[model samples]
Target: MQPMALWKRVLILLVCLWGIAAAMPNLFYAKVEAHNDAVAAIEAAGGTATAEQEAARAEWPDFLPSALVNLGLDLRGGAHLLAEVQVEDVYKSRLDALWPEVRDAMRDLRDQVGAVRRAPSPDGILRVTISNPDGMTAALEAVRALGSSVVTLTGVGQSTLEVTAEGNDIVVQLSEAEKQATDDRTIQQSLEIIRRRVDEVGTREPTIQRQGEDRVLIQVPGIGSASELKALIGTTAKLTFNAVVSRTNDAGADPGPRNLILPSMNEDGVYYIVEATPVVSGEELVDAQPAFDQNNRPAVNFRFDTTGARKFGDYTAANIGAPFAIVLDNEVISAPVIQSHIPGGSGIITGSFSVEESTQLAVLLRAGALPAEMRFLEERTIGPELGADSIDAGRIAALVAMGAVGLFMIASYGLYGTFAVIALMVNMALIFGIMSAIGGTLTLPGIGGIVLTIGMAVDANVLVFERIREELRSQKNPFRAVEIGYERAMSAIVDANVTTMISAATLFILGAGPVRGFAVTLGIGVVTSVFTALLVTRAIIEIWFRISRPKSIVV
Candidate 1:
């Protein structure tokens, strides 16, 4: 047998050691995972670990890699939601924003388009009537001038607003280009918000992705139910600072056309009429935390970005002794009088809130509000019992496959087959090690893929063994036969595994969820199996041959 170079021998030994070390955490999965979670919690809290947490952290050594294979929804059990975003909700907001611009532009053409009055129209349409009918064309031009070009690749050169004249009235709505762009932004923002909310709860491996233009798909493992997940993400949290016009006890009060009446969250009979335009938006908020007020009541403390701080400072400075409403999702959370200038852009929101409510509110504010409301179209909760049963079944199947494969290999070729069996064990370890290293998730189908890989892993060894038997019959020398066997089988092994890898790549690219999980395990298995079969097995055989110095070998 030809001896391997010192560097190659060391490299092979190091790889084997790494695979063993990386795969060791799985032996004590619960303890290791608890340790990792405790460390993460302590870090997130920006403090030292508690006694219990420190004990948990000490359970696993810091010198060793603690990453374990992430379990997929099928194995971990969690909540799944398919939510559809209300993208049209932004249209009215956009048009309302355009009102100020439209009014200003028409003010420039006051001589041509007489007095322009805003007439209430449908949800997405903004209607303005000019007293002079002959000046309708000029009014259309003035409104169209307020529109800017759409910034999208497909929408370049197209105007964001669609303006048309019906009789003496000028109608405005978002153009198709603008609507599409808005939908994309809304879905993306929704996905980000959902991710933040989920991550805040410290869940492992939550998948939040955009499904379509107006839909999002969320899968959170280890969560209690779909309703709980929904509660975390469903709140619009649309916080705004609107100028308070008046506070009334009567619910039927209509404040003017440019203002809005919102019901009080705390008081049943109180309502506030506020200006439609918000001085500062929650989107400008950078940080929020749960804190106790001076009166020892639960409250959410918030800090704003530079732009918001300036706007808020200016508004507060100008409106001392006047009331301003903090609006959340069209409901007036509180309407407080601006007693003094709040220049630092830091404030507390006080209401009849519990500690839990304050914490949830802070989390929502920090996560940023969803751009639009989400209606859950589909919801599901997977129980942990089902996942446990699946894991048990997969574990039993793997054990059975390993036993059968080992017995067959050992019975066929004795010492050499034992070497192949050992290589096979290393191959499986390396598969799991790589998966854990890469933070790949393991699902039910992923277990099936692993089992399938176990059966296929020995194919290269089988080819080499068969080739060795043929060479032995012709050459009559054990060392020469082994050399020729490996050389002859390399091409076939490479071709077969490469083709299978291509198939796994296709599955990973086009498949979703469980199918992709299976593809990941399968692909990793192929690469590891090839390495173990060719290098690891050959190294073991060479070492054995050198030690034994066998003149003749039995096949």
Candidate 2:
């Protein structure tokens, strides 16, 4: 057979070499990971590295490729949690926001209605009592004007607020369609917030997605435990600045109608009664970082967006000499007097905190608050020892599979089988290299895929070899048999790999977590196996034949 073109052969060799180099980092994963972390820390800290970090950085050279395939939860043994979000909390928040608007709308008819007072109601419903029942019609009209169109597919023309009156009470609640849209938005936001919280700490690829209507599944690899994960991500971090009405020592003190009694976060006996409505919420925060206060105490520095900045500036200006509370998760952290109009949307949060606590608080603030609280329904922590055992088992399985396949190929087809084995090894390297390059995660099922691919990698070569045997039986010459064998087998090889590729793609699109991990490796293996069989193995045989020309050959 004629040799391949010079450029083509050169390209083939380069691809194999690239794959090997890209995958080499995995052989020393711990060292390379430490090196990467050290380099990242130095860069983040303005090119200053600790002595330990410098030592770690020396483990891997900067010029070498260091990308690695992330290990999945099951393979790496980490935290797994299934949590249910309290979606009803969003309904309460919506009602709280409507209070000011509704109150203003009702105030227009104050002569007829007399007085407007918010009365305690169920979580989603808003009840306001009017002094005169005769103004019910005007009250309803006023609230209805506040209704805006819901911007969801199903609620195209529906109003967001539903207003109705019963006796002297004017009741307001979210419309049914609006509630549905709110629930979906809340869940999606929760999912994104959790993912951000997980990714903020630089943990490897985490699986965090919505499951049922109110549930979310979280699997974070390389974490300490499920409880640790819950602590890291489950905190709502609901930061807000509120108008403090008064201070009290009673735990169950009544804060009148429009105020809430919250205990102090640091002081044991102190509590503050703050307005139910927050002047500026955490959602308006644009950025947060760990910092040190003027006293060199650990603190969190926060910057707000334009709208929040304006609101904060206005509130501080109007409420000078009055105390406002910084509340986080319903606990008053500080109630400092507004000394002056603090502008520019930037401030510092100082409290009794360790360096680690300040850093973690900053991360949470930057990631944003969960729209609602999460209650963990299930939690599991896989230990490192268990993960190491799993890795060993998977490694043994792959090696046994590869050795068995190699033996069978050699026994079945003799000399040509050795070339197939070499190609198969290259195909395996290419799979790892591509996965590492793409930052794919390897799960337990992904190990199965690799083993399965090791067994199937030689199938294309087997077909070509069998076809050559057929050609020899038909009185063809050796070189002609080799050429025709490849030509005839090409259609079958393409068809087989194409079908497998479709299946892998379907799984990748429809599946989640471990299933997607499996699909990723399988899909990559299919392409690499095809390349090594059609080109790498064939090239080896062609070069061999060129060097030692034989008249007759046995298959």
TM-score of 1: 0.90
User: How many backbone clashes can be found in candidate 2?
Assistant: 0
Spell out the clash pairs found in candidate 1: none
RMSD of 1: 2.9
lDDT per residue for candidate 1 within 451-516, as digits (tens), equals 999988888899999999999989659998998899999999999999999999999998878889
Best-performing candidate as measured by lDDT: 2
Model 2, 125-238: lDDT tens per residue? 999999989878888888899999998989999999988888889889999999899999999999999999989999978998889889999999999998899999999999
Go through the candidates in order and give the C-alpha RMSD of each one to the true structure: 2.9, 2.1
Top candidate, metric TM-score: 2
